[model samples]
Target: MLIDRTHRPWLIFSGAGLAVAAIGYVMYSAMVVGGPRGGSAVGLTYGIIGYAFMLFAGLIGLRKKYPIVRVGRATTWMRGHLWLGLLSFPLILFHAAFSLGAGSLTRALMVLFIVVIISGIFGAVLQHFLPRLLTERVQLETVYEQIDSVRGQLLEEAEKLVADLRSALEGDLSFAEEKQRAMAASAGTVGGLTFASGLGASEFTSQIVADFFDQQLRPFLLHSGGHHCALADKGQASGMFSQLRVQLPRNFWPKLADLESLCDEKRGLDRQRRMHHVLHGWLFVHIPISYALLLLAAVHAVFALRY
Candidate 1:
């Protein structure tokens, strides 16, 4: 029943895989259930496959969000984890079912298998659901550098304007200039003022351009070009501003007022990485803990035998 695990894939894969496994188990159970020779062997096989598959799922989750390894090629290994878990479920149940009135060690081993299965199932649900939800909430957001790219462009344009402002206020015009010339230079012009105003354009600042800066900045400047210099202090930023605005959505505009608020952008990636760590890390917890449980179960068995 090893069909192509694509094209209505999950349905076919799970169904066929389960069918094949069920058939194999039925054949084995019927062939040997009455015999005493194979019971221990079946239990041991169940314990090995169950532990191995639980370990594999944890390993796959551990690799999540690794920087250099983007995809992790996790799809099939994950599917294997699912199929193997389903397969192991029956194996462990059968192992337990046939061992009625077994020793304390046997009961402890069964309890351990049950605990591992429940924990692994809980982890599977969390890994599947939380990531998709996180991605949707953060769809509008992006990396800080993308927005920083905008602020960088704006600051470059602002610096150029400041240089132009400096020449008019300080280079040609000075405190010696007459009051009339100073007033005229301050009057504001399209190509900029020629008047020798002492307090010339060098006073240009972000506050001056603040009002004219709209969502469609260049158009607002072009349409209001006549009064652009006179009405607002410095006028709108260049097409550079438009480029950055277009990179983001309309809702991003209000958020655009400050880029630091874009922290939600990285949340999805972080959540996946975190869950991966938690799931995988449990094995580090589980291996040592399982050894201890096995040891304790063995001790209990030895005491029961001695008694």
Candidate 2:
């Protein structure tokens, strides 16, 4: 929340320029007079106002992100951002003035405005609601990664499977007898292991039938009760994302995919990175299309000039 009050001069100056633009737009009706066939004076006014709001929001973001170079405090910048987001839509729509069909440039700008507005709203949702959810999910993700890593360690330990099988075979262990022993020796331990310590019980033994080999004939292993049996139960209980948890949901988590690198370096990160990405990315949509609209506008303008 640092602002150099000393830079008040610049802030006042820029703000004064904004005031001038706003006042001029509001008072200057004749400037908006256009061709009889296309566009509306009132709609253009609304569009300009909305554009002003959008521009201010962009400025606020830029100032906050680069506070050292900013002339406003974080709180003030945030206030500006919030107010602009709330008010700008109506301002720009005034520019549109409900006229969509009469001009190519108007239609193009309308599409751009709609896209920008929707993307901005999504950004707001990310800023407000998404951070808390992401925090809980991050903790949950930590747990899942830890589980996977612990499962890996258990696999390392389970490497003793073949050697243990050989020794048991030498004792002439029958498949039924081995099942009895493995079950009795470890009734609740799944795969003769546990999920605790990332290695307490494994889910591997219960999923399929065990094979009995000859020569070094050993008794087949039996299923031990495991927590993974409740995976479906756990997901259903969460109520967060039943649809996404399918076939390794924890590993291929969705939120992380949107803003992974940013989340690592910052807290309360949420989908800001994703929002910024889309905002800037959508510029390609806006800029090039604006050109087409301008081209058409120019065609209309030239046709009018000759007549």
Candidate 3:
């Protein structure tokens, strides 16, 4: 998937095989009476070999589907799928004598093959680079399916932090101490700020913090919240939090910093979701079309043999 050094052997083998096939096709074309026709023995051999490569490539899906059944190493199958799949295209062209088929079924198969190859290449490129990009961008990445659940947890955590801060600001030392202890036990430290003994601030500042969280941060954390929320943008969120910090007492800054960290984590999750979609989205187009191509190719092969 990463297209690293492990791919080297497959790449070398594929390149060598392609070169040999190209050479054979060239010699066969030159020696043929008119041109290398698909019905010719050499051309038929080319088609068979190309189709075999395609079948092997398509079986990678089956390999994935039944991963528990160890036919071979998955990495081997994947490498074969990527390299042999690519090799099939040029071999298929050689089989067709570099012409789009004159018949409707063959033409359709050719078109479908083209689509599959292009989509496969696109997917390969994405797999090669998007993983590294995802790693660099999403530090708090979680399981893709668990993103919603994690977001819910983050919301709860933010709410608890806000309540603790509010209690501290309102001079409820006992409640704030209990909450801070709970926070320390659960989260330890947030954004490098340790949970300390509650520092008292004005009830007015607590109300403003509560109002800001409800109006801006809470909506941004909600499941149905759209990207139109101001906190969705990093610079805008930073500026808003900066302004909120100016209004609040210095003691409340740690809780606010924790809130900002939570928001940043949420943003990272959102980014991971989008990138995950992009990473696999090509399969929606590639897979179904590939199956169709394989089916039509079978039909074409049968028709060629019979008629």
Candidate 4:
């Protein structure tokens, strides 16, 4: 269940009631029969009901695959799947008479079922907490599938910013040099002044800006995960940008600010991508094992009936 609102209470109540009823039936069978044997009539009934619940639980995945089918609200199906899937384990245990059956195939099926249940529960727990964590942390949250394209756009924006800064700095440097030349020529004619200093400062600042982008900002923004870059470390990025701000002229501060903002956005995108992975990673384990469990259960059913 999600961390925000509680899941439907009635669903939980109904599943628990049914599970309790099934448990009572199992107890009755245990008393009536010499013991709760898997091949007994009551045990077969439990197996059929347990398999039905498993089928219903598996349909939730199918429903997700084709969401256009409006049989019911998705939340309804998910709630049912979660509760009934949980309930199926107890039913299957009842079917097995709380023990593995007398054959290797039965034992494998039981092990597979246990693994499937554990994976499903693990996935449920992740779904419950990870979304809330993401909401709290990533204000710049985006559709996960679009993260790559968004990242490319961010890189393009950063490149354009650097290009604009380069153009501005070059223009300023040219104007400064031209002014110094005029001053030099006038002073030589007048024979009253030597060459003025600080003519090359803008040029030096431009080089620093270019190197900063090429070495740090560009690589950090372009990467999917920000782990390898120094700017990925917020403290390091802040300090590096602070040093660059002190080095560059005051006129370039606005552009430097924009670059810093872009870096921050890139860090948010990186965090979002990682959290998205944490959110969905468990499906890799839960899904395939579920199908395998169902297939093995089918084979076991066939063999059990034949014998």
Candidate 5:
């Protein structure tokens, strides 16, 4: 979430808490005999409080997963997650006495904790910036889950436009073979829509538009096809559509304009898809590792206390 005025109280609280903990740790370290080790009363107190913060941070995931358990407002939970989760890192360091670890389990816990904190920070940074970027860039944004359905709708609308253009140009094809030959011969012309021998200008233009749609535009509209198409590049698509406008009659401009609009919307959807992935993909790493960290930490705490 954006770091705004709402975060002021949490920021102040986290900063003050860290300061107090630092003072306590310093005093405890000075009074302790062999230094404030994990087994000492003061060290144990640090570890317990640090772990409590961690547990609280982890519960945010559960809070999100089951919204029915309404213990607090989501914004409050999120603020706690961000600030307390960050606070946990330093508190954990204090618990460890700034050492990596004395055993394999402790070392593993430290590693996992470090990974979790780094991933959380990365995710927070993305969350802070990507929403604004998405709003500015993807004017046609739809719900992420509905992107495919929206794309399909856009494809259907484009297909209807092409079909209507073709229908409007339809006439008796007594010399259909000759027309095809003429189209093939004039393939080198602007989008292959030249006024060829024995072919009506409208018929030839309609055929060219249909061919362009099938060969290039259709793939661009498909879910996995845009990457390889010229239409995927804004500059190239604009140039191609401009050529179409110049080659075809003014009466067909409206349909071409509508087709371009559909393509633009499809591009916006593609952009939103990419931005959405960037915004959320880190959770795949952060969430799983966080759960593992908590589990391993619990194991360490039990073994340390018991043995």
Candidate 6:
């Protein structure tokens, strides 16, 4: 992951600090209370320290929301969020004397805290790899929000291609008709001429092209979520275009090739959209749960102090 080297020092520092705190808690428990107890002064110290780390980790989210705050490098804040956030778990366990609290509120806080930590870890893992997947797989990637505009442009191009194909085919038919008339006039015999060698064949070809566009290309280009369409599949789209090249005049082959490329680019953009959604989707689960966890922890702390 790109974050490895930058986060290494932070990871080490947090790990060492946690080890020291755990050892100190162990020694104090052995010397003082005969066992670790959450009500003890040492346990309260561990709780305060752990909660401080948690608060710092949570602030990273605030920092992201307001980048203009200019407190520190985002990378530094991210590293702290990752390493110190992980360290908070063990510290909180130490605070509770490695026991689940007896009260219902404390149990709920523990469950919520575990869910938040697990979701954060899951999100961090996704961030590490999803960007690389997007870069390698989506060469024509654009801003996700701009996809609709780009899609409309692609649709316009596809429509223009169909129009050009029809125009070119009609022009071919007119030329063939003119040439046949010239031949018949020279020979002075029209009754023996076969219809297959003239305008009728070109008209047939135009109809075939029009039908293909209406049935296949139009739906693929004009619809939202064309990713589900047959043309969105690379092999199928390529084969369909190959068949089109065979059916259309050789002169129109280049335009068919260009259309194939546009389709592929549209497909790539769709993939990028899906991947971008995946990269962010976890936050929907993580953020709200984290806020809930924090709120529960605050309430638990208040009740503990009062009772």
Count clashes in each candidate, considering only residues at least 3 apart in sequence or on different chains. Answer: 1, 16, 0, 0, 0, 0
- Candidate-wise lDDT, in order: 0.46, 0.41, 0.85, 0.77, 0.82, 0.78
Give candidate 1 misplaced runs (Cα > 4 Å).
Answer: 1-74, 98-101, 139-307
Candidate with maximal TM-score: 3
How well does candidate 6 score on lDDT at residue 216?
A: 77
**Which segments of candidate 6 are over 4 A away from where they belong?**
32-34, 172-201
RMSD of each predicted structure: 13.2, 13.6, 4.6, 6.3, 6.2, 6.2
Model 6, position 174, has a per-residue lDDT of 43
Provide the lDDT at 16 for model 5.
Answer: 97
Clashing pairs in 6: none
Which has the better lDDT: candidate 1, or candidate 6?
6
lDDT of 2: 0.41
Put down candidate 4 lDDT per residue, 141-192, tens digits, no spaces. Answer: 8998898899899899898777656644554323233443455433321121
TM-score of each predicted structure versus truth: 0.39, 0.38, 0.89, 0.84, 0.88, 0.84
Q: Which pairs of residues have clashing backbones in candidate 5?
A: none
Question: How do the residues 120-236 of candidate 5 rate in per-residue lDDT, one tens digit apiece?
Answer: 999999999999999999997799999999999988988877765564444323323354334544432222222233235556777888898998888899764377899998899
Better of 2 and 3 by TM-score: 3
Error of 2 at 60 (Å): 4.2
lDDT of 1 by residue, 1-307 (tens): 1223342465576577567656755666778756422235654555455555545545555555463575545666666655665556565555454453366666766677566666656556656665565456445433433543443444454344433433343434342235424455455332333432433323333223332343333222233122333312222332434444564324324323332121122232334344445545655654454455446544643664466
Candidate 6 structure, TM-score to reference: 0.84
Q: After superposition, how far is residue 215 of candidate 3 from its true place, in Å?
A: 2.2
Q: Between candidates 5 and 6, which one is better according to TM-score?
A: 5
TM-score of structure candidate 1: 0.39
